[model samples]
Target chain A: MNEQPVIRTQGLTRYFGAKPAVYDLNLEVPRGCVFAFLGRNGSGKTTTIRMLLGLLQPTRGEGSILGHDIRSLPPEARARIGYLTEEHQLYDWMRVKECGGFQSQFYPRWNEKIFRGVIGHFNLKPTARVKDLSRGERAGLCLGLTLAPEPELLVLDDPAMGLDPVAHRSLMESMVYLTRRSDRTIFFSSHQLADVERVADYIAILDRSVLRMCCSLETFRNSVQQVRLRFPGPPPPLPDIPGLLQAFRAEGELRLTCVHYGATTEKALRALAPAQMEMVPLSLEDAFISYLGERGEKSFILSETEAQP
Target chain B: MSFNITISTGLNMPIYKQITDQVWLAFVTGKLAVGDQLPTVRTLAEDLVVNPNTVARAYADLMRDGLIESRAGRGVFITRKRKVFTREEGWRRLEPLIDAAIGEAMTMDFTHQELREAFEKKLGQWKHVKGGN
Candidate 1:
């Protein structure tokens, strides 16, 4: 395994007019880890990715991708990265095989077998024109092109955007195949939390221009927990619990979402003297929603009365 | 052997832990036997559509627990040897399982006494089944 990070940035800031899109971002992506960049819409994920790939200029600070400066990444270094953006850009008039043929001309390391295998996996015909393919088929074509070269680092922006369930699974298998060698690193951003939960080893979340959380997938899942406390009556006022992401009441139970839930947090929770309490496990999506949800908002009414109609 | 492993993300456990538990269950239920070959980390990850490292961690845990062993070039295989744990280690491992069960029971409004009686009744049935076998 390589000792150096595949991608590193220091004070990477990008501004649009007067407003900041990404601010003072310092990130280090270790070698061979499947890093997922996550955020709500317009939260600087694409901006950060564009800056890393040198597609967009930054307002200030510096960064490097694959050991080359992002601002002046040479053709040779750029060729070693397989970039698949949301737009699956390909010539509309070209046939599938023609697309591969044209792309293969630029990279000396392009593998014909990899191209054919991925195409077959996606059930794409060699004669299919780029304009005739569906959105998912086009995505498959782009993935085949990007993967044929066997790039050292793959940067994907929302790879699962328009993919169906089966196509998404194929994409995941493609990723797993890439990392089989233990040296291929993938940096992708997606709104598909389920897929991200499955494939990502590390994750960096951009919360509205701020780098909110960056850690391993397990660490992220474990850190943000939901605790449900049931009282004999309506729930009491919640204590000033640190790291409290959200607090809500529903059906006489007070539920709290907290980050880095530990002993002191448990003690404070216990002091409320609730009739019952238990930590509710959250899936990655649930935790992500809670982590980003409004703080201190309460009330989720199941029904006005217990009597059934 | 026809191997089928399913992973559920909705569980209270992590993916790696779920894998280990399923393997453990398979071993105890005789679905997996000693010397039976297990899928390689890469194959299983691709099959499950999960990170290979997650499967690798589960395999590492199974090996640590003495339920499986990896042959240098061949692949991972189930082993007959089960680990002998010290008392403290045994308690450490069992504590979480006990805690979860009790927590569930408590949430369902069961008292400690009721849980104890239920456990005792279940144990008696298990003993009688073993005796009949």
Candidate 2:
């Protein structure tokens, strides 16, 4: 493992005019790990990626990519990074081969073999014009270009969007192959939690321009859990237990979502001694929903609660 | 050989079950053999951007099924030489999901033939890719 993080941000903030897009963000992406930047639509994920790639200037704070200061570094620093935006546009008139050839001129270390392999694997037709490719094929072409450059880091904004199952799986395999061989760091943003859960070693959940959670994938999984308890009538108030992050009630039942359910919260729940209690392990999607709810997003709710104990 | 696993969000099946099923398929098709090292839970989790616990749960399930084993100071590895899936067991494991998918397809105005054709096509593709012939 590389000792220095490939990407580091300290209080990184970006604003659109007066509206804050990303606020006081601090993150460390360890070298060679595929880090997932997760968020709902318009949750500062794109803004953060833009700032990190030097495509947009930050309003305040600092970030370093490959040890180069993002704000101070020229395009040369960005030249070492491969970034695929969500709305990636390709020239419609150019043949797939022409585009690949054109992109190769910008990077000195572009790998023709890998490019050919990926193109073949994705079954992309070099003779076909960019306009002729399907949405998923277009994304695969962009991925081919990105991977060919052999950059130290890859920043992908929803690479899986609009892809069929086979294409998505192929793209993911290419990413895995790249990371494993080159030890490249990948920072990808996606609304697809399942994809994120599949490829990312670390995760950062962003919501409403704020960093909701950031941790290693292991820690993130270990920390959160969904607990189910049925009450006779209205549920009692929850105890103010440390590590108990959030709680709410459902139909004659109380649900406690915890960050790290230790002995204290267990004892606290046991104190209630409901008719029946079950601890259901949560998936990443469930955890993401709970975290977002706690931040008052209002998209989903646990239920009406009596009060906090 | 390491295969990258991707799970579909819109699919009705649980993500862990998908992982387990894919890994088992890989093992059964000779794509992954005994002693082939599996990606670390963290690496696989990051690739999928899922919580590590979810992948760990899948790993634990695989271990329980005797498909993979964990080695101290190393990592998980494919253990089963060949998966033993009886017809009934396989159907029992997959029937509910297939039924749900078929129901969903029907609701989307897909004819029975269309649904069956799609399944056959996917099954053919899987065989072609995994057969390595």
Top-TM-score structure, candidate number: 1
**Candidate 1 lDDT tens digits, A1-309:** 548889999899999999999998878789989999888899999999999999999999999998999999899999999999889999999999999999999998999999999998999999999999988898899999999999999999999888988887788888777888688899999887777778899888787787766778877777788998888788888768866888889766899988778887888999999877778888777787777667622211111121111
Listed in order, the DockQ scores are 0.49, 0.09
Q: What share of the true interface contacts does each candidate keep?
A: 0.58, 0.11
Question: Which of the CAPRI classes, incorrect, acceptable, medium or high, describes model 2?
Answer: incorrect
Tell me the TM-score of each prediction against the true structure: 0.88, 0.69
The best candidate in terms of DockQ? 1
What's the CA error at residue A284 for candidate 2, in Å?
1.9
> Across residues B6-117, which tens digit of lDDT does each residue of candidate 2 receive?
8665343456778999998887767887789999987886577454556788999999778898999799998864555666887797776675576557547999888888
How far does residue A2 in candidate 2 sit from its true spot (Å)?
A: 7.1
